[model samples]
Target: MDNEDKKQDIKDDENKEQNIEKEIDNNKISDEDKKNTEKDNIDSSKNTSSKSSLETKERDWFFEPKKDGSPSTVPSDVENVIKNHSTYFLGDTSEKVIYLTFDEGYENGYTGKILDVLKANNIKAAFFVVTPYIKTNKDLIKRMVDEGHLVCNHSVHHPSMAQVALKSKEKFKEEFTGVEEIFKEVTGKEMPKFFRPPMGKYSELSLAYTKELGYKTIFWSFAYNDWNVDKQPDPESAKKRIVDKAHNGAIYLLHAVSKTNTEILDSVIKELKAKGFRFASLEELK
Candidate 1:
């Protein structure tokens, strides 16, 4: 009887050890699942943030700054057309010269090639840069400045001046001095001479304000639909449109992001040269 009781107690101890082992295995599986779920949540959040950034940038191309310096009063239909008018093609009056100005808002992947084309041809052009572009792309901007290219202000937020009321001197200061301050902050140089409105949309009041701030309003007369990245013009067509439309004192406004511009730039320069046209920087013109 004593031997049987001891055997029974040993059997119970073995069973208890087995149960504890099973519980530990289950706990480990639960922990692994929790870790995986947390990792998936983090990945989902990163994707959402990326999508949000792309959306914000796409919408920002046309919106104007509000009274509080945030995006507001964005006219969806006319804003793009208004902003592009700064690249006017005024035909030659005193001499056969065309002014070339490129707007560098952000890299769309074609600025370096454009610069290479200009540099290879030994031609000079004006570059209009915003604050962020100047800061982040400082190496490129400095190269432009060092290579004798003119760097001008295109406004801090690229805000349209036509939207401003300009009811007071402070309003005028905001329109002109605001951009100047940004250029000064980035390059450590004062820019008080020339400015182009965010989108060619400007009121007479805005022009007067600019002049009061010792700035000349730059407007373009010739531009093509090259800002649309997906619907790009063919290289041949871009070359033709530009070569045919160019006139004396024409300021051609081309976005640096256009692939057609990069592909056809060399030919355009050569053809213009063959046509007895000379290229001039914005500063070189009267």
Candidate 2:
């Protein structure tokens, strides 16, 4: 062939290769399947539906599915709507600091020791309590307040906020109001505008309602199976897990009822401090 004819033939070969690549890319899935896949993707991404759209209304809570040594994160669905919406999972990323919070559901006599360790360390923490805990441990609650610690509303009956807050505004209102009244009655000070949903259970609407009620919703960056008073974690291993996961702007959820935590709190604090991690109150984020 002549020079121009050869060039045209090469260009035709390139076009044929490109078409073959397109065909290979479409292998296994027909064009019909591809169209259906695109439609399914779009449908799955629609976040407009409210909680009422579902049949089985289980309160959805976010837990990090993997632990590959980065700071624990929330689901994109949770993060998308609540971004800049006053819901806090961790503190600012400027320093190696941790916020300590305890869910006090009827203290099991170890909260006093936990408080003693915190006092000795001179680190303040946020204590989330229910109304029953209010009447049950008035002195401890006051001490948490008087010691300059934060008292956060954990709801009245300790119900999952996802089940209560958005579902019934009155029930949600009564839940927080009851706890606030008891806290005010005991501590003689208004409770701080901080809320941690019970069992780390929450929904977008629950978060919005809590924010509307003048509170910042709190979730933890790091927590383990420490809620059980009966099945306490081994102190050293628990300490290791906590210290290993230490990162800037971490929030730790520890149950006050765990004797393991009570035994390890002082060491955990010291070890984290040794690793250059300082503790801060949730008020810092608020």
Candidate 3:
């Protein structure tokens, strides 16, 4: 009777050990499955973030009422739409900084004089140009680089900027990369990662598109109808308009195509300086 009881007791101990081993193996498998599920979730989040970056909504950009001695404003709808993306309609309000920008869609023989005026005043500005402008005006683009001025991206073509919202990720990236390639090819220098929408037209999606490409989407606080090469405005009156509308954090957009701008730029600079407003580069906005 004692021997049989001893054998039964041994059998029970072995069964208990086997059950404990099975539980440990099951826990190991469960832990591995949990880690793999967590990894999949993280990868999924990353993919979603990248996809959302390309799928952006659109908003039309419009400058608010700008008057003499008054700071320009941005529309709230536009502002609300683009606030998350890297864009600026105005700079630091506490500083009396004037941002002078020029659009160069094509050469009109006025850029050189404008450069001269800017050089004479010792103020650095941002000049935005399309690909054709860069290809044709390599010397001026080089001059801008050598003189510490920023040559910004205006796009590969002077197309309507509203279409950027409809672009696929590849097409959206192409707009910026296309210009950067040509700019680097033509001037042998890296282009400044700043952009202005063509024809002063843009959508919130376009702003986000540019921001995703490592660019700062710049909009003017003040701009006039200065792009006309033929029917240019009166130089005296134009100068007066530019200066009188000056305010803190002013981003003034002029066109290099305008003969009046080339002629009146010096006076504009002098008058703006006289009014206690200092010209600054776009970088200061950051």
Candidate 4:
């Protein structure tokens, strides 16, 4: 071949080598980009998982009490969570109605009198009773049912329902079904599909589990420190606290274990009735 032709051939070989090298570099860069993209996707997935967990964490039901008879305020997100689960804390805000609910963890020798007051007032209330309460106070449970009141499942062992639900869905199911089985045995009827989490502690996951069981989780709009029998609020103060906090759709949570509640329940009902607030059953909640 001529010397010029040989030189041209050499130049062509060098250009091919350069192009091959550039192609290898581009493949390496593409591999590195693929790895980086995978890592970014993993990080985004972890963030989404963390956010989902936070959204379902346990929450204590709370409301800001208003003394001027305005509907109490709950945190918007908390309210949304309750509402999304078909749960209820307040009823129709347009009507002056109150839903009276009693949490009976155990017998404190006051439920009978409270029932008497309710019977006298023609107020049908809901009584959330734990398994122990149902087992030991079968007569009271019977009385609650016979008097046209609702005997709701408050859980079997009264553990944090949210924690129970997170640990095992079957266990959570048992918490409710256990109470229901015994209630049916005692009453010869199927228990009402109502529930109240132990100590007002719940989560979106727990509430969802409850809803799946065909139950409406009942929360309260008005509650005082009446659960502690030892540190019961003064009867007069409790009556005023209850009466003054009376809103259009108040769900008053009273502990049946409180002697003070038994003492003041009748008067509170009368005072609220005087103020044109009618007692409503949970079945009647709008």
**Which candidate number would show the highest lDDT if scored against the true structure?**
4
170: Cα error in model 3, Å: 0.9
Angstrom error at residue 130, model 4: 0.7
Full-model lDDT for every candidate: 0.69, 0.83, 0.82, 0.90
Ranking by TM-score: 4, 3, 2, 1
Question: Whole-model lDDT for model 3 versus the true structure?
Answer: 0.82
Which regions of candidate 4 fall more than 4 Å away from where they truly are? Answer: 1-54
Cα lDDT of model 1 by residue, 1-286, tens digit: 6989989999999999999998999899999999999999999989987534321111112323233222123354434433332322243446778888888788787878888989898899988777778777867876787787878877766766655533565764665566566666656777637677776666544555566666666666567798788899988988987887766666778888788888899999999999888998777644
lDDT at 112 for candidate 3?
87
TM-score to true structure, per model = 0.65, 0.77, 0.80, 0.81
- Writing each residue's lDDT as its tens digit, candidate 3 over 1-286 gives 6999999999999989999999999999999999999999999989987656543444445677565577887767666766887888788768778989988888988888888888999999999988888888888889999999999999887765668657575776777788899988987878888998887677666776678788998888888878866788888888878887888988888888898888888888888888788988898877
Candidate 1 local Cα displacement, residue 195, angstroms: 1.0
For candidate 2, list the clashing residue pairs, or say none: none
lDDT of 4: 0.90
How many pairs of residues in model 4 come into backbone collision?
A: 0
